[model samples]
Target: MKALIVDDEQPVIVSVKLLVDWKKYGIDTILETTSAADVPALIRTEKPELVISDVQMPGLSGLQLIAMIHEIHPPAQIIMISGYSKYDYMRSALQQKCIDYILKPLDEDQLNAAVGKAIETYRVEASQALIEQSYDFLHSELSKKRAQRLFLLYHTSHQTSVIWAQLCEIMPAFSSMESCRIGILPTGHLPSELFSGARDLSLIVNFIHDLCYETGQSIASEEPIDRNIHILFHSELSNIPELCRRIVDAVREEFHLFLPLGLSPAAPFPVNFSDAVRQAEDAVQTCGLMYTRQPVCFSHVTGKEAETPPVFRMEEQLYTAVLNGHPSGIRIAVRLCLSDLTSGKGLTLRQLLLFRTAYIGLRMRWIESFRMNHKTAASLDAPPGSYFRLPFRDDGQYDLSVMEESLIADLSAISDYLKGVLGMGPASQNLFQQIEQYIHFHYAKHLSLESIAEEFSLSSNYLSRSFKKKTGSGITDYINNVRIQKAKELLENPEIKIFHIAAQVGYSDEKYFSRVFKKTVGMSPLQYRIAHTAILPPLDLM
Candidate 1:
């Protein structure tokens, strides 16, 4: 990609520059020095892949230059130019591993041929290096996955000794480990779109693995579930706090996100791995309320065990509202439940997440009963395992306002659908209006026709047909229109980055967002921002 030329003659340098087309060989940067003494410093700074030098120079001879280049960057390719064609000179050049030896009064064709060959050689070596790197990465990932599977089997199977033997086969270090602590790290309430793809998930996992390796602590085992990674570490490794700090800092620096890590008390290795995992999970939930990008240990949590009676009461109220088809009561019940959870002492994000899960389950049960009684063909969609991702503010504290808004929207959609089914609400147009409101509220989420239909307990075909007939547009078109409109509003703020805007508006890929924006608004996001944005004059500090 880059080349350096060393010679004491300026005209020769100009002639050599004119003789060959550097760009043709993929050398975009060319460095030239008339003094051989300057070549070493240039090599250090520029890191050229190819070098061409004259045999006779003021300070260093061509042989000395070639040796120095090899010492500094062994992979660099060199071509030697000499006025004399003596056998000794050519032989010495070849001995120092120069790619080619050429007599001066340069032949343009000979120079081009040598340069082409050197470029090709460099490309081949680079490709080989990349292939080796990819192989190593895949090998590492396979080992981690295998270890995770063994861990799961060890927990579930009655034959623990057999699973432990297999785990030891894959990770020999585990056999020698005496005691260990488990740490659960959750990718805290960043946009779900950030981890929706497999590549992003692998990136985060690999980053943690590499970081753990750097600290001289090999992960004994790791399990990834619901945006969380459970990492097991040897108890003797006392640098876990420092390691967690480094991990959090690196993740924040690299992904502009927060990662909360929770640690458990030391337990006997292999035997107590399951209990350690549960303790670590509890630690994460306990500390998540006051999390500030630091590792929280189980021993550090100070609170009485959470009371379940109030949560159960609220659940009953919510079920009653849903069964009675009281849309307003559903919103009221949800708000009250959230209030009770947050107001309780020792309240945890885990509690809120579990409450969300329980609510969905109850709603499904009610829907099933309704279907059985009426002999309707409707069934509730399968709920996501982790639905309520506790939203956070920029300061890394919980954002209850946004969470409440999203909760209200989600529950209201279900209530509206039930209301329609019971024939207690207004016409079909009213149901479409409720659907529009739900789309506006949750446009940033991964929304689809099937997902929306599932939420409302309707078949996808029926929902699609009814929505189009009532709204005069397809459900997908309406979602995209909402997203594009939201994107336009976000683009108005010059401070927000385009990619962040893309994620906020339900499009994970920035380029795809731009294409959709252009198709809808007749201009790319940047152009539209520039056209609509008013230029502000500089602030006077003087």
Candidate 2:
């Protein structure tokens, strides 16, 4: 942005100019007007995006100039640089929408932040103006300026043309240039272990913008997401893998802010745009949980277990593992299955998608299982732990939502898939089978402790204790586990209402069943199956 320095003392203007590395902030020309008397005319001609001025001047004090300039350009952002201690001056400046007032003998870091904040405001307003909007008029000259004021709304559409126009308007040196890629940097909620404070993050954010600007890439947005600073940049250089590593190093050395950054794998296809954002978001999610410390791509942000499973079958088993509260089992099972596919070498893109699908599905199922009240429910339902899932469709081939929907439509089918039908063998070879059968056969048949003990030739107390010991749960727990599982089966069938799902699962109340479902699944049972069952196979075929 073109910035104007307005102060009475030429030496202060020169000192401020010398201290600032303008090129590093993509500033081409630093306009100078030492007296506020010259500002109204200079401002009318220059139309600078930002103004750095002293509060006290020989004539037309900064406050007066601000009022006059604002009368012509209400959207202009000004930051008062002052030595004055008067609260009245500060109050007046602040009320006039002075972006920031930096105390003199200035802090370089503070000055940079004030400047960055001012430019950020400009970019956001400009970005918004360049985007979609309708205009209004009152049939007067005032309406013309008001229409111009409509640009105050900020947005992101990856609009290079808008930024290009902005670069021309502000700098003019690169008005005709092209071939820049806008990178939205990760902003907000970084791991506390890495960054010491908000001040530290802010400094780091400023340094990043400086780096990107120096490197011919400009920082776009400073908005926070997940847990890190967000910036946008467009670059001319290649070997971004190495470029990304340097960025992490700069954050560490420049401002003592350690940040785990996710650089989006360059989107080769237009269709991959949304996926690129997911990759960036996924990187933050990993760092927020402190799962990884190195700069990374989203696919590798998690550990080897996160490497997507090879085929649909193994993926389904691992998903069930998540539901069963066996994270280790899911990891190991995934490793074994992936090893079979890749011989433990590494994952191809298709395998990665399948792996992600399995992981999300398992996590989603654990969510669904939580909503039921089977004695087995607590044992079977759990979370995806540190990893959050973001699955989206880029084309017809990437339809996980549809697959999840279909899977929910046939919960029993998914259950069978989990049971290893057509893959591992019959469900009888498992310990879960014993629990599953016991619940199914005994659920509505006076299956309480007393009768089960009599049938098993043991005392009621003894049998209950044994059941709890064997399953890490009580007999009541086991019964409820079965009921909830059955309830899920009934809930998945469109033929049955939730009320019946409750009754069939051995509860007479649908309201109670819904409460249980919401607890486990993080959604209603109906929503769970619908979200998950509408699965689309991997997106590689096309």
Candidate 3:
């Protein structure tokens, strides 16, 4: 694609330029220098695929330049030009692997033919190099996948010695290391569909490798377990926080995503690797719930495991309200319980999540009591344990306002269900209308069948069957339809990006949103926007 010409005479360089249409030979850029000494430096920097040189120059001769070219860029195709027809020069040129030898007082046809031959040779070498590189890359990837599987097995299996031996066969460095620390880089709240494609996963793996290498750390092994990438590090524990910070910053700058890293304390190599892996996993779980932006360590969480009485007292008040069948009392109790959990000093997000889990267990016991006492009331199906799982922001941090609102809504729904069974609440038709209104209001938030059912104190099966029977649509379909409708309205504004619209409509993954939009509107989001709006400048799908 590029050619460099070296000659002592400026006129000779100009003649070569005018002799033939270099563009016809696929040489778009033509560089020239009168000094032979400058050729090697140019080759190193510019890396031109084709080289044309005069045999004799002021400083370094063409044969010497050819030797330097071979040492510097061996792939460069060379054509040697000489004024005299010297047999020794031709022999040396051939030894240096020059593609062609042209004589001075250059003939146009001969020069054109030589340039075409050089271009063809360059293409062939480049194609061959690409094939070899691809083969190497595939072999390297295959080895990495095998190592990842061994790592998973070693961490999970009781026989660590056997797996470590197998791992050292591929990664010999592990045999030399005495100890290592494990770190988990969680994808946080990013949708799993973002990594459903191998290209995306490979990009992430390469990006992480580059950043870690820059920080003077090499990943011994990296395995994707659940939503986190478990990385083995031979670096010191003190160096880990800074390395993690760099990795987090780089990922944020490059991928535009927040990646939280969690580290475990140093553990002895091979034997304690499983414990290290588990500690790293625990650290990530804590980091997922914490409000801080820094990386978390398993030790830090263990150091703050003190008891809090306020959470317990507030939970008791909530339990008492449910037992008394007081709907208003339940609302007040839910508020106070959440407020107490959040207001306490040094209370981590993990504590709040734990308290919620305990509260759900107690609530289930209360429901059983009601069933035993009110035998004449309609049969009440208990919601699944998963229905009460806390909702977190896309960044893997809790939003207290959203959490409080959701808790109130679901607990209030339970009160309504209990009252309805006792003939003290609204009719089924009115309740369904209220549910529809609630969905319309909170459509932008994370809404799921289980959470919605939990909010109304009704069983998931009961709500799913009843709602479809009345509205002729499933809850999930209704939710997606509502989101697509909002997305269409947002798409009309050309200023907003499609991904932003996806977030605004409660879809975290843009690609997933596009598919849903196409399924609902009979066209992709961009196509729909183009059809409805005036022509506008292009914007990224992300």
Candidate 4:
């Protein structure tokens, strides 16, 4: 912004100039005019966007100066400085839409504030002009097209052209890809929510560009279309499945939520641009619950829709059960859903999303019903307009559908993890299971670590890792927890002696048992028995 300081008092003109820290507001050049008559000439010649003029001036009053300046340079914003707290002068100045007024004895903050306001008003007007220009172009483009064609055009009519202008600025040179591979990655639902006030999505656009570039993809453009990014290339497409997998994995790693990366039904950037966009949209939509299990592209191990039997009708009942907090309903829904998978018609990533979306929505509803004080069905933290609400952003973690899919995928990972372990082979896994069942049935025996490890036909190290992985706890820890539980029951039976309880829980040595008991339960067995030794019904031996 160019600021013209106008005052008949030369001292006031210089003082105002020196008082302001114009550079802080991104303004630097400050012009001075001591005479009111000089104001119009200075404004016209300098074309300053802002004018700070003294209300009382020789010959032409500050109001007159502003009027003259306005007629010739309508864009210039005028602010009147007055010696008196006169409402009349202030009212006249404001009526003409002067930027602002500041009384004499100009404080530094006051001058800067006035200048800041004038500059802010000018910037807003300038931005409105850009938006208008973009809008006009779209309207003109629409005018040239037929009615039906108009409706099918890029819907983000406002942000598209603006982003296009930026795209031109960034990729001033590029026709299409011919060398390196390019993957036009798809995002969940950001494109649809762009026009809707969800969040600032510009970073998402750039992130895709940067990711592709860094991942050895010769991307050509960083254009934002609606909410989706057009991952153009200066080359071909390759390992799109692997790219999809990595992308999904990276997203899962960074964001707690999940979205399926689709192979975009088409590939290699020299493709039908519109089709690329359409398939990209499909890829995103494929992230919806019913299709979340099996991936169609590079995204990854998603639900296989073909394998997922059509249980859409039962979804409502399942969801209703969850929303009603009927655990039995949850169990049933889970079993039914799992049974559908048993058909071996594995679900596509999108189909799984459909189920998960229903599940998540139901879970949220159930939580809401318990928090009856709320009116809307959104989460309590996200009730209505809470700032810390669950995500609906196209790319952020914690999107309702994505979060559920991710957690399910993580748990599935645990199962997959177990299945891959060497100990989990049928012959081996069953042996461990048998040994574990035996231990539970015979915990009162004089069980020894060597005997247990030997029973499984495995070295202690392998058995230990296997047991810990399958049960998510070490065998020793589990045994202690179980033994302590049994000890508590025995301690309550006043008919039992502390020494006898120790012997029954597999320890023949009472003092050693006391030491282990204190380590496990923070008390000696005798003390523990004393604390909770009331007589009770005998526990079933089986």
lDDT tens readout by residue for model 3, 418-505: 5565443444445665566456656788999998888777999999999999889999999999889889998999888888999999
- Local accuracy of candidate 1 as per-residue lDDT tens digits, 452-539: 8876667999999999998899999999998998888887777777888899989888888888889989988888877777953123
Give me the overall lDDT of model 4.
0.56
RMSD of each candidate? 25.3, 21.7, 22.5, 23.3
Give the Cα lDDT of each candidate.
Answer: 0.72, 0.55, 0.71, 0.56
Question: For residues 112-188, could you state the per-residue lDDT of candidate 4 as single tens digits?
Answer: 88888888888888788899999997874343232212212322253244443443333433323322222344443
Worst 10 residues of 2 by lDDT: 146-155
Instruction: Name the runs in model 1 displaced over 4 angstroms.
Output: 1-3, 10-31, 83-90, 100-176, 186-228, 236-238, 246-259, 293-297, 313-340, 353-542
Can you rank all candidates by lDDT, best first? 1, 3, 4, 2
CA shift at 232, candidate 4, in angstroms?
2.1
1-542 per-residue lDDT for model 2 (tens digits) = 57889988888898888877777767787899776667888788888888888888886676787888788766578988888778888988889889988888988888888877888788888777655343222333243222222211122344345643554453343343343322334433222444455545555655665565454443433444344455333334555556666777766565544445566655532345445656665554443223224454444433333443554556445444433323354456545654565453322233444555564665464445433423454455332243322222211122234434433333333444344421223433443443444455447555677865654456877777766766687877677666766666655555555565666776666677677767655777667555545443233311
**Looking at candidate 2, what is the lDDT of residue 2?**
79
lDDT of 3 at 285: 59
Prediction 3 TM-score vs. true: 0.65
Quote the positional error of residue 447 for candidate 1 in Å: 47
